[model samples]
Target chain A: MLENKDPNRTDLRELGEFGLIDHLTQGLTQSQPSTIKGVGDDAAVVDIGGKYLGITTDMLVEGVHFDLGYTPLKHLGYKAVVVNLSDVYAMNMQPTQVTVSLAVSNRFPLEALEELYSGIALASRIYGVDVVGGDTTSSNKGMILSITALGFGKPEKVAYRSGAKPNDLLVVSGDLGGAYLGLQVLKREHEVVKVNPAHQPDLGAYHYLVERQLKPEARKDVIALLEGLEVTPTSMIDISDGLSSEILHLCKSSGTGCRLYEDKIPLDPMVISTCEEFSLDATLVALSGGEDYELLFTIDQKDFPKVKGNPNLTVIGHMTDQGEGANLVSRSGSSIPLTAQGWNAFQGE
Target chain B: MLENKDPNRTDLRELGEFGLIDHLTQGLTQSQPSTIKGVGDDAAVVDIGGKYLGITTDMLVEGVHFDLGYTPLKHLGYKAVVVNLSDVYAMNMQPTQVTVSLAVSNRFPLEALEELYSGIALASRIYGVDVVGGDTTSSNKGMILSITALGFGKPEKVAYRSGAKPNDLLVVSGDLGGAYLGLQVLKREHEVVKVNPAHQPDLGAYHYLVERQLKPEARKDVIALLEGLEVTPTSMIDISDGLSSEILHLCKSSGTGCRLYEDKIPLDPMVISTCEEFSLDATLVALSGGEDYELLFTIDQKDFPKVKGNPNLTVIGHMTDQGEGANLVSRSGSSIPLTAQGWNAFQGE
Candidate 1:
């Protein structure tokens, strides 16, 4: 189903774990001030009524989620925290505390765990999040890392996935699908290297795409950018499961419709060219490719002017009547229905 | 290292996940009204300031913190939520919302997940906690689950782990060590079963002890019990890592020393006999045994009588000046130094 649906997709391990996270998190634009901090922290911290604190956590296990030969523990640790913070950041908050939980079999020695923690500690230090409380146990199988991030945010400022609105401008922070294409290039090269270890494939040619995949940064910049532009999204969600799914979520929650422009869909040049090389459709990749942690939000049209022309802010579309449905305008300007191809590992074998 | 610690501990699977969680959560008495809900829920729900809400979460993974063969996933999930609520309850707060994150390998079919979630869902329904949100994904190896619980309490009502005072009455809710002894019985049985497939041992003989090991419940009941008695603990923590380690945490955090009475320590008769049969000391099991989910706390000396005759509350010790070391009075009435036997999977191999 995934192959039939996401032909533009490449193997996840190609870009590697670290690179995939970095690529996905890049080009994000945050738009709230209560968000004293966003992604990159132990837990995104926010100023919640300037009183108490809130926290959330998530875990990712390899072989359970991704193949290890292709996934780096460092990137795995970093991405685990990133996913948790996305939820907190969605609430327009700042993250401060974190608890790192890791489970490994005898296969992982102290050094490997150290490598994973090195990334965790890097995230801790860089994001100013404290390692507060957690447990480390041995797994019966592969490696698993669970991260809980605590942040400070006002009760009123916290956003839920269910807050989109009709007539709200459908805005997305940063470019899309670069991470997906980056995976394609890395997977292609990985296959080549597997057949001939001596082959020094020049990934340099796809430097931008590769970097986007390897070091995906959470759109920490967007929080500041949105604040500077003086706009608050009426409803918001981080784009982890691709644009199509997220837009559908916003539309369903806000009881509205959306029409995305094919020409307006943001993409780096390398993504389009890479899609051509794979005979894949760039639009579909933009719609269904997962992993980008960019913010997809809906704002009151009145605030649209404030976000418009902002380098990081991309006005991908706008909300419409409920019956209009979620669709994308082709480059030639024909509307087409949108569908999600996000991985559901439990689906029929 | 584990050889001397919990070597006789049985595999968790023999108890199944549900049985294990029930063993850990038994007889935990509640003490506060704000804790409108406890242990059985998506999240433990608490009535904060009568209107506001507060939430927190934590996750545990096997291999990272436990061995599933010895740690039941049901008990793991139960303990996972218990530990997180212990944090908020430590704050004199109550849990209100919770989300559980789980990553499982195909090694576990949907039936396995159903059993795991049945406990979680049951806890939520029983405790009145809402399963507001959660993220589910595939794992590379075994299984890992993370739980986040949200709670609420008035600003003045919330208690912090650091709030214990010098000379506070160190009180424990419920008996200790059955969970540990239960482990021994299971291990013995497991060994027997492993050596002879045709042998169907008399499990009824160790029912009580096995139950404690297979299903440990949180001390949410103690929260209500304390409230009824009109007493409040100055500092609190749930027993997950053992009494010695937890008391030490309160002592160090509160900047005090402690004296625990071995004679006064509560132990189920089954625990005592099981330990003797296993050639292990019951006191050591009480000190190092984890998964009790009972509350270890301190209260004002004036409030002593309210608990003195209460079967649920035990005045096992008292806090002292930092100059005094953490010590335990032996059953023979001798003072012995206390040391943490908590498993350090990180200990250099």
Candidate 2:
């Protein structure tokens, strides 16, 4: 009954998450006058009289999004809220409230839940967002967390994914690759512990990377910094599914192309050292490693001086004409096509 | 470090969903000025310019909330959206936008997800709400659907569970017990089918009951009807956890007591007949068998004349002073205290 039906019954793995979402929501027509902008953005925008309210939702499944062996319940709870808040911040809005819904198995003790809630409370307090509402229910397997963040900003100040133009500078906040590398470290340690319970592998050297994986914070500070600098991004998004995937999203939504310089990609010293230890390319890790929770945006060239040499900001690339296609300028000065090989949840871990 | 922690870690089973949520959110403080109301209400209320926006979220897990063997993906999708919208309506607000997030197992085909989205599209069309944004991911087990609904209403017109006063007449829209009874029938049929592949139990006589279970509609019409009649509810809630549980919620939140007349409870002929067939007490089914999706609200005694003879509404009870606890006056003239032995997700199916 669907127009997009495949006679051979295509696997979700073939379409991937983004392609599946696009395929499913192909013809969705928004009818509400209050809906200023709908799908295909970091967050949906609603016209609420004096300002625009940005609404975003995210779902984190247990086995898919997390592994409880190393991930503390507290950090999991905090990270869940931060991820949703990142989407709101991507819209240049300060999250005012959030509703968290969970489907948890009975295997969790009340103490464990208290730990989770404590982390949630900490995130709410630290971010200045209220835990407004939530539903708690039972799950048959591992836990699932779904969070919805609501934020507001003046209509003129809010950024959208579809506002980029040619020559706009593409900038990113903080660094990348650390969270993904942290997950690798945790996984490696988990395997080691499974094989030899008495062996305690020192994780001190990878503390920064491990912490980024376990307790990454959203770049709410980036939003504030940009505002203080009087810089309005032409387009914006949060890098959750790797920098490459997010840049592709911005380029596709804005009908533009981009050229990202490999040397310009921000990577912490720890990230670089760890990449070498693992024999992985640092630039590739920075490009496709996900869960950075960093802000990626494009700014008009005229505002470049304001953000130039800013400690937290990195000028990584610039938007280009759609016909040029998105490419990464390697350190050796060769242009290579950028593909969105980000995390595909449908693909078994 | 939690004050409520037991020397022996308390199992989640001991507290159940509601008790656990209450226990976890004990000290959650709302510091955001935009957050006018938080936590306990059907929907969180946020002041947005001239109106109050109601935000609520619900999560439906496959084995916990539905059985794929009997439930059509389309109906499940529609029901998921409707249930969330019901919360917004319970706050006496008109839902204008919704964000649906799903985590489905790879077992589901593209067509299956299409069917689900089709149902969501249908719900949005029927309810006049916009499908704004969402996230889709993979789950390890069965499908999970989480929806967040956004709605708005004038500040003065918004109904809160805490607004009920003594002497206000408690009323309900449509009938109850049908949805719960429908579940009983579906569960019976599911068991029958499990035992014999060829067995197809006749369900023609229980059409309404089965439909109520599979595809219950939210009472957006009730809000419209009340508006048309110029009747504003002093307190309101949607019947999801049975009448007894809802009444207790209203009473506790409003700091009052309630008197529900067993004889005055509205039940369809189908509900009564099915209850008899199942040898279940019709009154108990109406009182504690939840998922009716009907609006239960209280109106001031002064405005009783407006809804007194309305065919769509039935005045089943009235508010009382807090000193007198909530009770149900039965046909035998016995006053039985109401208990909230409603669905407890953590208690297991």
Candidate 3:
């Protein structure tokens, strides 16, 4: 009875990841009274008794998300859990538990799976969350990991992407572009190893960059910091897909515009030096390079004093009226419209 | 530093599915006070205020879990959600929400995904659960679906697999063996289609079996019926890995043995007749057939009167002392040990 009604089949690549999710989930309406937020958010919020529970899930596919040739199974497991927890942290929630599900082919031995789970367990212990449950099964090809993170937050303390108001200060925790550059270093090393099997390359100089890519720490501490400072972000999102894409998400959801100052964007000395060596623009990398796993948020102008001059946070820009549009004010005083040049799995594959 | 400690790579098949999960999660311990149960349960139970929340996840891999040649995308999507909801129901919790994640190769078009989401939405609507959040990405080969179901129940009313005591009556909802028989018919028809293309084989006679395989429903109605009858099960589980395997799990968790009566095993007329047609043993099929999505539970002897003569449930056996061991009494009066002949994704590949 479920025949293809349309004569022409539309290619999935025609609409990118965000567009595809939006198209498919357009008709779904929440019927459960407990479901506070369903789709179109970092995490779905549900009211369990008086507490607000945030639930988020993420999937990592082999070849699509990672390559096992260089990526250790343990790090892959740790990063997979961190990716989901980042979403919960983005909502200003304290993560309590996670459910990890995996699909692996016969090529993965029992020892390999054990190594993967060790990393998962380590992450669970470090983050103070319980590994409550999961499902493991055989896949047709390589490994696929899907994790669901559950966290809780007070009703008033929870943050959302749609809560930003015009004139709020845009804030970010930690530096950007390191993770993306780290991946570049790994990919280059992998290519070298492919050509010469016995090549022993010293990566001492790129230790920081490689670690950023391999083992990203989700900003659970930032959520706690915000609570300690008595500052609630007006809007918040995790920087999984570059700064440009995340800024657009907050602006679109909050029905506002933003002016991201180029000079104010946070960057480490290592990122600048590495970008110079690679002949890449540091600002462009920070704007378009993804997988930072840092929190990008906005707070009311009155709360600026709380985060001002804080090393953990950078005041990158400020929100503006919808008519002003989202733009990047370059150091040279040029107004450039921000575009999502972040990694799109569907495109350029 | 995450090097393989063992020189010999042990194949995953040596451990099997259940063994792999147990071995990997062996070192994990619950530190969260909210986490009531973890790892080894139908669903992990967490305390949210005074309410109990149950979380469960399941993964379905193409080629391994299903063959898309005959399986419709819509049915696959519907069944994925049902599989997870069944776990929540096994904990005697009311499913509140679900997150459905998908990883598909470029072979699937937008229409295919839309068809799948339609099924997901349909199932969500019917089950009274909100479609929360999910992740969709590209896969290396075939499609992979992972679903997480969230449910809620009263603290005192939640059932666990370890609560069964000796003398408690074992019961199951719905008949067994239909889904397994349905798969056999489909496989036979698939072979016929391969041999003679364009051959129109009638499937009208096997409609019930095929439906049982393609669109089996979770026991939500049974949960409500038990509540209406004021009968709360002491221990419960879902029949996903067949009666033999589920009975063993209940026995192992509760430290009790079970005496399953073969004559009391429920079977449909179609199932019995089809077993004869296929030259298979009906009792064996019923015992080892998986994917029934039926609820199996143990109730106190005092509560037997509440469920007695109920068409939705059948008293099949009773829990016994741990020394007795789990055994099934044959119709001819022979007590045979119950072996788990259910599908093992890791073995026989």
Best by DockQ: 3
Candidate 2 vs candidate 3, TM-score winner? 3
| Residue-level lDDT tens digits of model 3 in A120-156 | 9989999999999999899878889999999999989
Off by over 4 Å in 2: A1-7, B1-7
Instruction: Give lDDT per model, in order.
Output: 0.66, 0.91, 0.91
Mind giving the per-residue lDDT tens digits that candidate 1 earns over A61-170? 66554445545666666667666666667666666555555565555544455556666666655665555445455566766677766555556655555566667788
Model 1, range B52-154, lDDT digits (tens) per residue?
3444555566555555655555565555655676656655666655656777644554434555666665565555555444556666555677776656566
Model 3, first chain, TM-score of 0.97
Q: Compare candidates 1 and 3 on DockQ and give the better one.
A: 3
Candidate 1's C-alpha runs over 4 A off are: A1-56, A64-75, A94-96, A124-131, A150-160, A165-167, A192-202, A347-349, B1-58, B62-79, B153-167, B191-205, B228-230, B300-302, B321-323, B346-349
Candidate 3, residue A65: Cα displacement in angstroms equals 0.8
- Candidate 2 A-chain TM-score: 0.96
Please report, as a residue range, the 10-residue window in candidate 3 chain B with the lowest summed lDDT: B1-10
Give the CAPRI rating of model 2: medium
- For A50-85, candidate 2 gives per-residue lDDT tens digits of 899999999999879998888988999899999999
